[model samples]
Target: MRLRPPDRFGSLVTLRLLFCHGAVDFNVGVTTGGGGMTGFSTSDLALLLYQAAQDKNRWPVLVAALQETANPFDDDAIYRNPAARRELLDQLLPHISQALDMADRFESQAVSQNLLDRTLEMLPMGVALLDDELNIIMLNQQADRTLAEHEMLANHDGHFKINNREQHKLLHHYIERSLEDGSSHALMLSPGNPRSVSLLVCPADLVKDRDDNDPPAVTLFLSNPDFQSLIDEQTLTDLYRLSAAEAELTRDLIHGYDLRSIAQRRQVSELTVRTQLKSIFRKTETARQAELVSLVLSGLAPLRGRESVTAKVADDIGESTGLRYCKGAHGQRLCFAEYGDPQGVAVMFCHSVRGSRLEVPGGDSVLRDMHIRLIIPERPGYGDSEALDERTVDDLAEDMRCLADHLELPQFHLLGYSLGGFLALHCAARLGDRISRLGLVSSLAPPGKEAGKPLKGMMRLAVALADKAPGLAETVLDHMARTILKNPRRHLGSSVDRKLLAEPDHQERYLLALRESCRQGSMGFVQDLQAVARTPLPEPSSLALPVYLWHGEQDGQVPADQAIQLDRWLTNSELTLLPDGGHFFIYSRWPQILANFVAE
Candidate 1:
C-alpha cells in the first residue's frame, strides 16, 4: 500500500520534510499553491494528511479536512455534493490509506483503539483510567456525563478529585495502594445525597500488546442510580414511537419511581399511571416494568446523552435556539445562535477562545430586560461553524462583517469576552463606522513584557505556550477545554466568585455554556490564541471608537493593569474595575455592561 507522490507535488515533499523537522512553522501561515487547480493549497493537504497519519481517528480527521478544504464554505456541502467529496477523497484518501496501512502492518492498532473506545462508551457506568499522580489518561463518555451531573467528583487539568476532603484522601490512598501492591478497593461517596455514587479502583496489568508508552496504573469505575437515566424524553419517544405522556411515564419509571409515586407527582390517578405504563410496555414490547427499564437501559438510549452539539442545547433559548449558519465572504459557514428580543438593539458578542454561541454571560432574561439583541457567533471550528485552514484576527473581523451584513445589522455594539477580546479589538479598528462602540470583558491584550505577569496556573501556561510554541499551546488549550466540558464543576470551583455559580439556576446556565464551548472541539480557541499572540497589539490611540473596559482586580487570567492601560490609552474610553471580579466577572457584571450599551 505505497503511494507515489505526484510529479507536480515534488516540491511539497520538501515542504513536508521541513515542517516535520521543525525547520518551518506551519502556524506562521505557511502556504504552498497547488497551481490554482484546487481551492486548497498543497501544504494544507500535506499537513492534514500528516496529522491524519498519526491521529487515531484518521478517517474523520482526513474527511473533515477534505470537506473543509474542498467547499471551504457550506457546512452541508459534503452531503449535498457527493461528487465533490469523492473527488477530494480520490486525491487524498489513497495517500492516507497507505500511511495507515504502513502503520498497521504489524497489528491493527487503530481498529483495536476504536473497539476499545466503543466498548468503554457502551458501558453504563463511568470509566476512567488514572495514573499514580491522579492525572486522567482515559475517560469514557459516561465518565463525562457522571462528572458533569454529579457534585461529589470533579476533574481539574485532567486530575481527578473528590469534593469531600476525607473521601478525596481515601480515593488517593486507594489509587496509591492499587499502584503499589496491585490491590483493589471500593468505597461509597456522599451517602445520604441523591447524587451519591460508589467508586471502585483496581490495578491494571501492563499490556504487552500496547505501544512503548506505559498505560495508566489504576482503572476507576464510578456509578450511581441517579446517573443511570441520562436519556431525555424526546429520545425515548423517538426511539419507541411512544406518545409524549407515555415517554414521560417511562422516564419516571426508569428513574426508580413506582406507579403510585409517579401518579402523585404527575397529579394523576394510579389508574392513569398504570394505563400509561401499559401502553409504554406495548410500544417497547416489554411485559414488566423491570424488563422494560432494562431493555431501554441496555440498548442505545444511554448513548443519547452524548448526542451532537445541535441536539444538546436547551429548547427554550429562543426561536433560533439551535445553530443558524450563514455563508462567510469566502463561502465559509459562519454559525451563530440568537437570544433575547430579535427586535431589540443588536449587540454582536465575541465568545472566549473556548466558548460557543451559547456563551451568554447572564442568560436571556438579562438581555430581554436590557432590550439587547444578543448574537453570539461560533468562531470557526467551534460549535457548528466551519473550520478555517489558517485564521487571523483581520480575517475573522472580515467574517464578522459578513455576518453583520447577512443579518442586516447596519450598526451594532461589539463585545468581546476573554480570548474573544482579540476579535473585538480588531473589529473595532477594522470595521470603523459599522461598530457603534467596543466593550471588552476580562479580555486578553496584546502580548507584552507584562503579558503573563498577571496570570497564574493554566492561563499563564497557555499564554507562554502561545508565545514560544503555538502548536503545543493549541493542543494544551484543547485538552483543557475538554476537561472543562467534561467537568464544569471544576471550572466553577476554579473561578474567583463561587457564590454566583452557587445558585442552581446560575450554575446550570454557566455549565451549559461551558459545555457548548468545546462542542466542536477547541480549535477555534487555540487558533484565536495564536492569532492574538502573533498579531500586533492595536495602539490605544488608533482605536478612536468609544471603548469600554471592564477588569477584575482579583482576575487570575488577565492583568488588571492591561484594562487600566486601555482606559488611559483610549481618548474617550471608560474603565470599570470590580474589587471582587475575576476572569468570569462578566457573568455577574453583564447588566452594568449592557446598560452602558443601551445608554448610548
Candidate 2:
C-alpha cells in the first residue's frame, strides 16, 4: 500500500519506529492469520512495539512515523491504518532528528554543572570564583565563613562588595598580578584584624582551560592560621615570671639595649625602665650584667680544659700510658691513672657514681706541668674498676686513704663532682690533717632521713629490684642512661660551644665514657648510696680544712641552694655560684673554678 507522508519528523522517532516494527514481525511474538499474522492480539502488538522500540530495530517506515509524531501514543488516528501510518512516518523524520538533538544538549549541560559542583566541594581551602569585573559567581562554605568572620566582603546593593579597606587593596593588587603576570599570589590579613587570614589569588584559567568568550577571572582562597600552630604568649610570661611592664624591659635587656633606649622606645621615663630592670635583676638573682649574660649564654660556651689551677702539667712520668690497675680496699682491682710528679704532693680526683676518671679534663697534663702528682682512681664499679660487695662512705674514705698510703704519699688534695663531692667532703672530715685542700663541684651533702625519706625509699626499691631481678634491673638502668647521662649533648644546650666541643674529639670521648660508666657502675653506685645512707655526717666544726664549693645557678638536677646551706655549715668554706650553669657547671665554667681553687 502507498502511504501518505507526515511533517515534523526527526531521526530519534524514525529509530524508535524501526525498532518497534522489526521486533513484532520477526523475533518478538506469535502470528495468528494465514496472511502471516502469527495470531498476535492488539495488546500483544502494543507490547511487542514497546520492546521493539527499546531494542532499536532498523525499519525505515515505522522509524519515520516515530520521528514525525509529537506523542507517538497520541497519533492513533494516523497509525490506525497501515498505509496512513507509513505515510505519517515519512513526514515525521525531520522532527524526530530535532528531538534527539535537544535531548543530547540537555544531558551535556547537566553533566557539566554536576562536575563544577563536585570540584568546588572537594577543595580543602576556602574558594571564591569571581568574574572579570570582580562580581562573585560562587563560593564554597569555607570561603563564605571566612568572609563573614573577617567582614572582608559584604552584601551591598544586591552585590557582594569588598568591605575591608586593607583587604580590598590586597585583593586589587593580587588580581592585577594574576592577570598581568599570569602568576599566583597570596597575602596575609592585617595585624589589626582579630582573626588571622591568608588570601591566595590565582587566575581562574589556572583552574579551567581558557575559552575565547571566557572573560578574565580570578579565584581567591581564604585561610585562617591554626591556633595549635602558635606558642602561647602566656607561657613566655610564666617562664620569666615578670609583670607586663617588667617583661617588656626583660626583652630589651636580653637584646643588650640600654635603659634609656628602652625607655624611649616604650615612651616611658628612664627611671621607670631602671626600676623594671632592678626588679628583673632581683627576680633573676643576678648581681651584674656579665652574670646575667653568662646565665643566658652558658649553654653556648664551648667546653675547655679544666680552669688552670696553675699551668698545664708536663708529662713527668715520661710515659704515654698513664693508666694502671691497683688493689682497692676489698682487694678488687681498681683502674688508676697517674699524672705529674708521683713524688710531689698528690691530688686525688673522684668522679660521681655514674662518672669515671676519664671525665677529668687535662688531668695528666696539669698534674705533670705543675710539678704536682695527680691520682685519678676510678670509683668501685666504674671504668675498669671491679665492683665492691659491701660498701659505705667511710669504707670509700678508707679506700682513698689506703690508696694514698699505697703510693707512699703522706697527704693529698681532694676534688670531686656530684656524688664524688660528697665523698670528698667525708674524706676531708675524716682526714682533716692529712688533706691539704678540697674542691666540690655541683655536689650536695646527703639529705637526712627527715628530708630524704622519699629518695631513700626509691633507692632502696631500686637496690631490691636489682638484687631480685637482674634483667629488669638492667632495663631500668638502660632507661636511666638514655634519659640522663647518655646524651650530655642535650644538656649542653646553648652553653656548649659547638666549635670547642667539636674540637680535640673530647665531647665524643666524654660521652662514650659516660655510657660505659653507666653500664658498669650500677653495683658500685648502689654500694655508694648505701655508704652515704649509713655514714654519719661529722659536725661542721670538725672540718678544719679549707673547702671550696661551686654550683651552677641554673642547675635543674641539683639545687644551688644546697651549696648555700653547705657554705653556712662550714665556716672556712667558700661558695661560688655559676650563673646560667647547670649540674655540669664545672664543664661550663671550669676556667674560673680551677683558677679559684689554685689561688686558694
Candidate 3:
C-alpha cells in the first residue's frame, strides 16, 4: 500500500500515525476543548500544535505559573483557543500530577512530624534522639528541662553524664541492645539527687518504622516517690471505696504485712483483720494481695493505720455477755449493757460521734467490775443502733427520751464525749425532770464562727470540693491528715496519746467507727457542725442536776476553750483540764477520769 503524508490539520491524523507504519487497523481518536476536528489522527495534530506552542517561551512561564496557582485550568483565554487549550491540557496534566505527588509527600511528612511531637509532649520523662555516630539529633521538652536543670547537655554533643553512673550505664546498655536487636527495651533509672527520681527507660524505635541501621533513641519516664504523698485522701477513698477502717488496713497491707501481723499490731484478732481485708477487697475489686499492694503504692488506696489499745478495748468489750436492746425515739434501736438491779441508779453513757456502744474506752469493764447498772446505748448509726434519717442535736435528745421511756427509768445519769458531750447537754435540758447527773469528757459544744473558724472553713471547702469533684476526696483527706492531723502543735499532735492513736489497734477502731458511720449514710458530722454553729448557751445558772466537764489542754479539733465556755455557761458545772492531752484525752486517761466520775 502507498503511504500518504499526514495533512496539516488532518482529521484522521491520529489513525494514520497509528496504522501507517504497521499492519494493525486500530482506529484512534482525539478531542480538543475548542473542537476543530476529532478523528484517529487528531491526537498527532494536537501533539504537533502543542509542540509548536511550547516552542514559544511563554509556554514554560504559563505552565510553571499554573502549577503554582490554585486553580489553573479555570482561565478563560486557555479554554477559548483551540491550539492553546490543547497545548495547555497536555502540559498541565503532567505538571499537575507531579505537583500532587509532591503535595502528598509533604502532607505525609507533616503528619509524621505531628505524631512525633505529640508523643514527645505527652511523655513525663526526658527523651533524646541520637544519630548513628552518637550525635544529638533532637531532645524533647522534658529532656531539655532535665538536662538544663542538671547542667548536663551543655554541649550539643551526646556526651552528657547522668548524676548516677550506675543508672547511666544501665540506660546506655539498654540503648545499645535495642539498637542491635532493632527492638524496644526498658531499664530503671535512679538519680542520686534529693529529687531522686525513678525512671523507666524505653526504646523509641517501636514508635517509628526504621531499619537496624537507624541510630537508637530512648524515652525516659520519670516518677517521683514523694508524689505518693501528694495524692489526695478523697481520691484514694473513692478509688478504693475505703471506709476509715479499710484505709488503715490498706496501709498495713501496703507495707508487706500479713493480716495476722496487722491484727497483732492492732491488738485485734486475725479474724477481725481478715474481715476488714474482705471489705476492702469487695470495694476495690482486688482478689490478690499483690494487687492491693500496687493500689496502695499507686495512691489508689486510702490512709489506714492500726491502733493497738483501741483494738484491745474492743476485744474486752466483745467478751461481755449481758446485752439489752431498747427502742429509742425516731425508731432507733439502742443496744446497752445491763448489770446490777434495774431499780438502782441508771447511768447512760454516750460515746463520741465516731464511736459505738462497744467503743466507750473502758466503760464495759468499769460497769461489770464496779457492780454498777450502766445503760450504754449504741448512738444512732453505731453498733446495733438504728440509723437516724436526720442528724441533729434535737433528734438525738428525742431519741434519748424514747430510750428513757422504753427502759421505764424515772432518773438517769448522763455522760458523753466529743459530739456526745453536746448531745448530753441537750439530753439534760430536754429531760431535766428525769435526769440525775450530767458529765462531759473531751466534749465539744456548738461551734460558732469564732470557735471553729478554721474547721468550719475546712468542712465547707471539703463539702464543696467533694460535690464539685467527688473523685478528689481521698487526696483532700490525705492532705488534711498530713497538715492537720500529723502536726503536733495543731489539733493532731505527736504526744504519747497521739502516737498511740497512730497504733494499728487504735486506728482500726477509729476507722471502724468512721466506716460504720459512712455506711449508715448518717450526715452526723455535717449536722453536728451545723448545730454547733447555731446553738446558743446561757450564763451559768443552777440546774436540776450536777454537771461535770473534762477536756485536754492540747485538744485541737475541739479546743479546751469550748469546755471552759460550757463550764461558765452551766452554774452547776465544773471544768477539769488535763495536761498534755487532746480531743481523745479520755482514751489515754480513761482510768483516772472514770475513777473521778464513779467517786462522784
Candidate 4:
C-alpha cells in the first residue's frame, strides 16, 4: 500500500501506518500530523484519516491513529462530540480484534514462512533482504512504499542505493562487513532529509523455503523514530470495560502525561480525572496510576497470542494461589502464592506450622475488597519450598528480601499468625526499612515467656518432645500426619481446639487447610516446634517498625499475657485484646482486620 505524495492531493495528507500483528511502530511515514499521525490538527487529521479509512485494510491503522492522536487535547477537536468518539471506539474494537485473530491464525498455520514474508509487508519499518554481494533479494511492502516516497534513497535493480555517492558507498561497506563477519552493523540515514532514519544491518538465519546452499545473508531492521506502538485503547477498553473517559485517561497516562496535564488536556476538573483514574485502577486491579502505566507499557493489552491481559495474567501467574517459585541463596526453591490486586499495597502473610497458602474463611473477599495484595510465602521446608536443616528464624528476612526484590516490592505491610508471627517479628526487625507496618495475631511470646499458662494435653507433650528431642517430635508428627490429622473430620470434635471449630463450615475449612499444609512432609512441622521453643529473636523495643499485636485473653496455646509482653516490649505497638477470643480469633474478625489494613 503506497502512500500518495501530498502534492498529488488537494489537501494535506497524514498517513499513519500500523503493523496489526506485533507491536511494531514507525513514526516517519506521516510526519506532519501526530503519533502515527505526524502532528496534524484535529480537523485536518480527521479529513486525512477519513481519506485513508476508505481502504478497508487501513482500518486498524486508523484506529491506531485515533488512539495516538487523541492525546495532548489538540486532537480533542476531532473527537469533540464525546458520544460520536465513543461510538467510533466501540465500533473499532471488534474490527481490530478480528484482524488480530486472523493474524494469529495465519502465523500458526503449518505453511512455510511465506506468511513471514507477507507479515513483513504489514510492518511499518522498512525491511530488506540482502545477500553476501549486497544484492537485494527482496524488500517488504514498507521498503518499496517508503522508498518510493523518499528522494535521497531509491530501489535500483531491486537493491537499495543512496542518491548521495558517499552515503551509498558507506551503506555498501556496512552491509558487506555485517555479512562477512556474521555480525550486525547500524548507521543513521539523513542526507539533509526532513527526517533522519535509523538503519540496521544484522545477519539473519536463512528464511525458510530458501535453497539448501544459499549463502548467509543479512536482514536490515530499520527503525522509524516516529513509530511508537502505544497501548491499544480498544484492547484496554475490552479488557477492563472502562468508560470512554476512563480509557482516554489510561491511554494518556501510558504516554507519560501527568494527572494535571491529563486533566487540562481532557478539559475536565482534576477531581473528575482523579475519579476516572480511580475507576481505571479498580477495573485493571491495579493500585496506582504508576502501576496502571506499567501495566499498559508491559504489553498487557492483548495484541499477541492471548485474547486479553487479565486472561494472560491468570494463565501465566496461576489462579487463586498464583504460585511462583524462585531459588534462594542456596539454590533451594522457595514458593510464594500471590492473589488479589497485582499492584495494591503488598502485605506478606507468613504461614503457621500447620498452614501453607490457603486463605482462611472469609479472607479472600476481605483482601479483594480491601485492595491489598496478600503474598503467602512458604518458609523453608514447607509446601513446595525446599527444606534446609540449617534454616533458622533469622534467615527468613534475607530470603524474603530476595523475593521482594524479585517481585519489585520496595516496602509493604507484614502479617503473621501463631508460629508465623515469630518469623514476622524477626523479619520486621531485620528488614525495618522494607516494612511499613507489622501485625502479629495470636502470636506466641518466646517459648517460656507466656505468663498465663503453658500448652496443655497432647500439645504440651508435643512441645516438650520437640524441645528435648526433635527426632521423636518428627516421628510423632509423621505418625499424626499418616493417621490422626490425615482424617481431620474424625478428630475435629476432640483432637483440635473445639472452641475455634464451633461451626461445621469452619471445621471443613480447617481440615482442607490442614491437609494442604502437610501435603509435602512432616519434617517442617517438627522443625517449627523446635524453633518455637528455642529461636532467638531481636528485642522488640529495639525495632522501630510499627506493630499491631492481637491476641485472645482466653487463649490456651499462646496466652493473652504474650500479647501484653509483646506490646510492652515494642515501643510503637497497638494491642487489641479479645475478651472471649481464642487462638483462632482471626476467623471471626476477618472483615475488621482487613478493613484496618488501610490507615494514616
Measured by lDDT, the strongest candidate is 1
Candidate 1 global lDDT: 0.68
Q: Candidate 3 lDDT, tens digit per residue, 286-315?
A: 888788777666553232322224556466
Question: Number of clashes in every candidate structure?
Answer: 1, 51, 41, 10
lDDT for each residue of candidate 4 in 82-201, tens digit (9 for 90 to 100): 444444334444443444345335435523465686666545477888776667787876667666766667778877777888877887888788867867778777735546677888
Task: Tell me the lDDT of candidate 2.
Answer: 0.58
Ten contiguous residues with the weakest lDDT in model 3: 1-10
**By summed lDDT, which 10 consecutive residues of candidate 1 come out lowest?**
1-10
User: Which ten residues in a row are the worst by lDDT in model 2?
Assistant: 300-309
Task: State residue 586's C-alpha deviation in candidate 3, in Å.
Answer: 0.6
Provide the RMSD of all predictions against the true structure, rounded to 1 decimal. 14.2, 35.8, 30.4, 30.9
Show where candidate 1 strays beyond 4 Å. 1-232, 242-320, 447-464, 482-511, 537-542
Worst lDDT 10-window in candidate 4: 8-17
Question: Per-residue alpha-carbon lDDT of model 2 for 195-229, expressed as tens digits?
Answer: 66777788886555668787777887766443222
Q: TM-score of every model? A: 0.55, 0.42, 0.42, 0.45
- Residue pairs with backbone overlap in model 1: 73-331
List of clashing residue pairs for candidate 4: 26-227, 27-226, 27-227, 32-38, 33-38, 33-39, 33-40, 34-37, 34-38, 34-39
Q: Name the candidate, 2 or 4, with the larger TM-score value.
A: 4
